[model samples]
Target: MEGPAGEKVPSDNQVKTFERTATGLVREISAFRTLVLDLMFTSPVFMFVFAILGIGIFVGADMVVSTLLALLIGFTTAGMYALLSIAYPRSGGDYIFISRILSPPLGFMVNFVFTIVNISVIGTEAVWVSTMALGPMFSGLGAIMNSSSLASYASVFSQPVYIFIIGAVVMLVFTSVMFFGTGPTFKIKSVLFFVAVFSVIVYIAAIGLTSTSAMISNFNHLSSTSYQQYSGIVTSNGLPEKFEVVPTL
Candidate 1:
């Protein structure tokens, strides 16, 4: 007999120790693909804001110590998952692995909660990518390149309707990519790896090549505001020149 995926299915169990023949999912994704997915999950584009949030909360924390601690935590967690993958090399993800290895009830509870969190993350991340990432990126590029057309496009992106449309399109595109299959999804992510690398290089170059004065000049050119006026406004409404802990729980 043939299984749904066209793989041959045994009519009877040959091994006396086994209860019966059962169809098992074939593992399709390679180790390299899994590594790529892991890299993309931890990529700066998705994670940079969280890193900033950590800094914000732990203001004046020792950078070296913080980094080492984070590395230790990440390494241990990643190692656990890596070991799990090695033990269960099937297409079935965390839910399947957990259910098979542990109690089904516990696995179900975990997967249920995870699914709920993932739904919220997906919606919010879509909106955030459009508004926070894309909007600022286009605006900054327009400012840097002095492109009136790009600036106009950025203004269009500022509207709620346009932002929603772009976010929906992004969500739809990714959903479709996943629905098609893992192979195509893996290829697309591999391409995005290059794009992410290029973005990081550009970001570093922008920081290294441009000075504070140049940035101020660009802002002035775009906003028609002088550095003195900007400084005054910042002083009036922003953080104090000297750092002090704000009242918080």
Candidate 2:
């Protein structure tokens, strides 16, 4: 029946608000699952583990201390994730929790900090990936230009231009996916997950097949004077080998 304002109005008994709400919640959950799957594929776990291994190998005996530090960091990170997840299971992340538990001012500060950290990470990743790409490119260019005395020119190619370009492209693609909404993002996530899993399996297989004798030889070299000499050479090439500070006296 039409109301006085000529608008059709529902009878109290005609509306199923709770059913509609439940349906919407289910859809949201499905979408969230896709988002999480994508994130899992793109996660930094492999890089993190490789970084820890590198530090362990390079720092040698100091790995004991590094391992302890990594453990402490991991524990704290896990605790924070647990606390945030539990506090806002429905809302599902730190932003809402921050706003609710604290004043809006504090919440903004938290978000600001997070933005800075995220951008810093993006910048660092772009540089690192570009550097990795440059290694082979530089080597190839160096060989080609060997007779031309263009090793310096080859060195110029080592700059992270490719890295920044690739990073920008990735950022743009992801941003577009976000704008178009979660459907495509979810698909991308599934592919990423498969790739990540396959890569991990292959890495483990390779490591397992490596010769024990070769591993021992590598370990011995790491412990020898040559390793220290190489470390010093690498460090000094990048930065001053020693710092001189004038005495206050």
Candidate 3:
């Protein structure tokens, strides 16, 4: 074909094959490691607090049963993700799978929205981690040292500007680590995963060793105080007149 400048342009047959380079990442992660990563992605430790606030408050006694049910549902969802991973076997994951099997337009729309949401949420997550995790750890150190001022210093993270700055710094650090390569990133993640898992196991063991009656009594006492404080707001919203604790063993 003739170019705009009257130069001869190469036809389709002249096109060269694009070569894909080796990323140098070995498939070193084992099944257990993959399971831990997947589980961490799906159900992070932060979600424990969310579940407590969302379901545990009302279903205090039955929270264990509710959690078990949720775990069953999570397993089913994880199975679906596994199937998709096997079918696609690519990094694009759900987007590529859906685009190949279904319509590209639908896949694009789904992924585009998801990408936007995910990107937006990273800032929130960074801010939360800084304020909730780091702040608490610093405060705990302050407490151990018997310095109230040091503990109060954590309040700086609660400021909007400081939160944004810290979140941005966190994003930059992680992004840099990822740019360096997955090896270091995964190593850090693995360490964090083990620590989180150990913490969760210890927490669960403590809960298991506690007496059921004691738990119920504590829940009832807390609920009674909260109910009295928020009864007016609850009634205005057409909620229950009183907080009722679930009766489950």
Candidate 4:
């Protein structure tokens, strides 16, 4: 019986089916793909490069201690998210949980702000890809090929217009992949993930074989930027010539 607006509301017995039978998306993403997606998001290369960039800012901070603390916190937070996912099987993500626990408006507001923040960070991340990944790749190739022009272009990632174009191209590529739909997107991501993994392996092998002096020499040769200049930056920042614990974070 309905009396509020003289309109009838369906009882549990009367409401047996939904207006729409399908929930729009088919769950084509496998467990492996899900893990791949997460790994791509948490790629250590990006984190390492970002930390390296922030070294001057965190000069006084203990590198080992900071790294350990970050790992501890990150793991704990991930564990909590995992537990929550297991508890709330079908429903997921920050927004879903927040909306359920708190008010939807508050959840929406928080998620919306975070969405904007993530979108804004896209350009920076793209620039990082240009500088950290492509620049390094080009430098390594230059050293191998003995091409000065190739080496010169290694530093091109720093140019404002070049970096902007790199960022824009990266955005466009990803957006185009998204337009192809989720299944194709994950497939493409999987390919990219393996390529990144291989690159990481090569990087680790190269680092293991090469000395610090050699790395510096290569950098100087490629970019025509002196190691002395970088050292000067540290010195001018009031950092000691020899730091007991060099902070990367």
Using lDDT as the measure, which candidate wins?
A: 4
lDDT of 1 by residue, 182-234 (tens): 78898999899889878878877987899999988877777778877977986
Rank by lDDT, descending?
4, 1, 3, 2
Off by over 4 Å in 2: 1-42, 45-58, 61-76, 133-157, 215-249
Where's the lowest-lDDT run of ten residues in candidate 1? 14-23
Regions of model 1 farther than 4 Å from truth: 1-24, 52-68, 86-93, 96-102, 208-249
* Model 3 bad stretches (over 4 Å): 1-33, 55-63, 88-92, 138-147, 210-249
Candidates 1 and 4 compared: the better one by lDDT is 4
Q: For candidate 3, lDDT tens digit of each residue in 1-249?
A: 899999887798895432223457535566666777776776467666665665435543455565676778878977887777765453436667677779889889999999999898788788887677777676766756767787786776667888888888989997888776667777777888899888888877978888977766655553435434564665676555443454322
Per-residue lDDT tens digits of candidate 4, residues 1-249? 686999767776784422323456536578999999999988866655655655556766655467677898899889988977876665577777677778788889999999998898887788877777778878878887998888788889768888889989999999898988888999999998999898888867987999999989877875555888977876897876654454534
lDDT of each model, Cα atoms only?
Answer: 0.73, 0.59, 0.69, 0.77
Worst 10 residues of 3 by lDDT: 17-26
At residue 188, candidate 1 shows an lDDT of 97
- Give lDDT for model 4: 0.77
Task: Give the higher-TM-score candidate: 2 or 4.
Answer: 4
TM-score of each: 0.69, 0.56, 0.65, 0.75
